[model samples]
Target: MPSIDLTINTDLARRILTGFIRSEIGRIGLKRAVVGLSGGVDSALSCFLAAEALGPENVLAVRMPYRTSSRESLEHAQMVIDATGVRSLTADITEMVEPYFARFPEMDKRRRGNMMARARMMVLYDQSAAFGGLVVGTSNKTEILLGYSTLYGDSAYAINPIGDLYKTQVWQLSEAVGVPEVIIKKAPTADLWAGQTDEQELGFSYREADRLLYLLVDRRYTPQECVAEGFNEAFVQAVVRRMRRNHFKRLMPPIAKLSNRTIGYDFLYLRDWGT
Candidate 1:
C-alpha cells in the first residue's frame, strides 16, 4: 500500500496554535473560551490548547451528549477535563432533540444526527455567552475538506486553531499535549448514533483520506495526478466530488449584491473596525 508521512513538529504546532488561540480570543476582548468536548482526539486537543492559551480556569469544556452517546465518551471527556483542570459541564442534548425526533418518527439517522449536532452547537453557543468566551472550533482539515461536518453545527466557531491540521496531525498534537491514550487510540466517531464511526460513514480511513487530501489540496495535484500518485481513481473522484459539492459549507452564506456596499462583498472588514 502507498503510504505518506504526515508527521508534524508537535512542539512547533503546539506553540503556534496556543499563540493563535490566545491572540484571537484577546483580539475580541475575551479572555476565556468554551469548547464542545466530544471525548474524541480533536476536541480533546482543542481543549488542551485552549487551556494552555488561557488558563484552565478560563477554558470551559462542555460535554453535550445525546441519550445514546457512549458512556466511554463521557468518561473520556471527563478525563480531558481532569487532565486540563478546566471547568466542565455535561449537558444532555437528548431532550433538546427528542421533540423534533418524535415529531418525525420516520426521520432517518442522518436527519436525526444533523439535529443532534446542531443541538450541541446551540448548547455551546449558549455556554459561550454564559461563560463569557468564544467557541473554539474542533473540526480538523480532513473533515472540513471532505465536507464531513454539519453546516451551522460542528462547523460553526468564532476561531478554530486546529482546522488547519489534518486528522493524523491532530493525533500527533494530541499525544504531545497529553490527551488520554484511549482517545488517541480509539476509532474516530462523532458519536451521533450508537454504532456510527466516522470511517464507516465516510467509507474511508482518515489516514488514506488525509494522504489523498494532502496530495490534492496541499500539493496542488489534479484528480488525474492524484490517481497517478497511487490513490485509487474512484477514491480520488469521490473525494473531489464531495469537496466541490460541499464547498458552500466552508463559506459564509452569500448575500445578494443589492447595494454597492454589501455585507460580505464590498464592505468586508473586521467588525471591530475602530476598536
Candidate 2:
C-alpha cells in the first residue's frame, strides 16, 4: 500500500469546481442541473458545485434509494440537501427495479448493481426533463480511469464536474465544500448491494489503487517502472488491463466515418465551431 496525500487546498478546489460548472453550463446553454445524490463524496461535491454555479434554486438534488440502501446513506444525502439548500426530491428505485430482479434472480452481483445504476439514471433523466435541467454526473477520474462505473449507468451525464479528481482528491474537495464529516469518513461503498464496499469490490484500497493509477496514467510509468517504485505487479497489471479494456467506454461511440469530418473521428475537437 502507498502512503500518499491526495489532498487539495480549499481555495484551489473551489476555483476548479466553480470554473468547471461555469464552463459546462455555458457550453450546454443550461440554466439548471439535476444531480443524483447517493450520499457519497463525489455526488456531494458535484451537488455543491452545481448549487454554486447555478444557484440553489436551479440545482435539484434527487435521492434515489433502493431497498438495500442504508439509513445512514439516506441521512447523509439529506444533510447535503440541507447544507446546500438545493431543491430536493426522493424516488425509491426498489419498486422500479423489482421486476427486473424477479426476471433474473440468478443474475450476479455486478449485473444487479449495473441495473440499479441505470435505474437511478433513468429517474435522474426524468427529473431533468421535468425540471428542464441537465443531469450532472459525479464519477471521479479514478473510477473513470479504472472503469469502475457501468456504461449508460453512472457513466452517462450531461457534464461531470469532478471527472478529473481522483477518489482521494474527491474527499479533500468534499471537506472543502463543507460536506458532512460522517459522509467524509464513512466506508466508501456504492451501496449497490448489501455489505458491498467499493474497495472490496475493486480488490484494493482507493489509497493504494489511486496512487498506482497516478503513477501509471498521470506520471506515465510503465508496468516494470511502477513495480520498481514499490507497487505490486499484480495490482499494476490489473489496473492497466482494466484501463485498456474499457478505453471504449471513455470515448464517444464509434462512427462509421462516412462524412469528411465525423463526430468521433477527425471532426471532433473541443474548440469553438461557430455556426
Candidate 3:
C-alpha cells in the first residue's frame, strides 16, 4: 500500500496556475478572460486566478443562474466578484431554458440539467464575443476524470488553469487565493435545481474519490492493488469504470485518417499556425 498525499503546495500551485492563465490567454493575443461563476470553489478559484493574471478589469465574471438556483449561490458568486473586483454580469437562464422545457415536459432532471449546462455555455460564448475574452473553464480534475461535466457545457473553455487540481485541492488553492470561507465550506453543486448537491449526485464525497483517483490514475495502481490498499472493491471498480468510460471526453473529436498529414494525428505542431 502506497501512502497517498492529496495535499498540494498551494503557494507553488498558485504561482504556476496564475502563470499558466497569463500565458495561455496571452499566447493568442487575448488579454481578458470570461469565467462563469457558479458560486462553487472551482469557479471561484478560476476567477481569482484570472483576475490576478489579467487584472480584475480585464476579467469578466458572468453569473448564469437558472430559476431553481439558490439565492446563496448567487450571493456567494457576488462574494467572489467583490473579493476580486472583477467586472461582472448576471445572465438569468430561466427564460432561455423554459421554452424548451415547456415544449418537452417529459424531459427528466438529467436531460434538463444537461440543457441548462449547454444553455449556460451558449450564454458564456456569446458574452465571450462581446467581452473579447476567452472562456475560462471551472471544472476541476476530479469532475473531469469522473465525466461529471456536460460535453460542451461546463467542460468547454478556451483555457483551464486548475484543470489538473482535484476537488480537494481546489479547496486548498481556493483558500490560498482568498476565496470566501462560506464558499469554501459550502456543499458543491452545479445548481441545476434546488436542493441538489454534487456529492449526493455522484454517490461519494470528493475526498474519497480524490484519494482513490490518486492511486488509480496518478500512481497507475491496478484496481486489485487499490482494493488491497483498503479501498472497497466496489468503489475501486466504479471509479475505474468512470475513468475508462469517460476517456473520450478528455480529447478532441476523432478524425478519420486518409491523408498522411491528418490534423491531430501527425500534423501536431500548433506553433506558427496563425493565431
Worst 10 residues of 1 by lDDT: 266-275
Error of 1 at 241 (Å): 0.8
What are the candidates' C-alpha RMSDs? 1.5, 2.1, 1.3
Ranking by TM-score: 3, 1, 2
RMSD of 2: 2.1
Off by over 4 Å in 2: 1-5, 269-275
Clashing pairs in 2: none
lDDT of each: 0.93, 0.88, 0.92
lDDT for position 272 in model 3: 32
lDDT for 158 (candidate 1): 92
Looking at model 3, which ten-residue stretch has the lowest summed lDDT?
266-275
Error of 2 at 120 (Å): 0.9
The TM-scores, one per candidate, come to 0.96, 0.93, 0.97
Clashing pairs in 3: none
Report the C-alpha lDDT of model 3 over 36-144, residue by residue, as the tens digit.
9999999999999999989999999999988889999999999999999999999999999999999999999999999999999999999999999999999899999
**TM-score result, candidate 3:** 0.97
Runs with alpha carbons beyond 4 Å of true place in candidate 1: 1-4
lDDT of 2 by residue, 144-252 (tens): 9988898999998988889989988888888877888998898888998888898888898988888888877777778898898788888988888989998888987
**Compared to the true structure, candidate 2 yields what TM-score?**
0.93
lDDT of 1 by residue, 182-250 (tens): 999999999988987999989989999999998888878888988887789999898999999999999
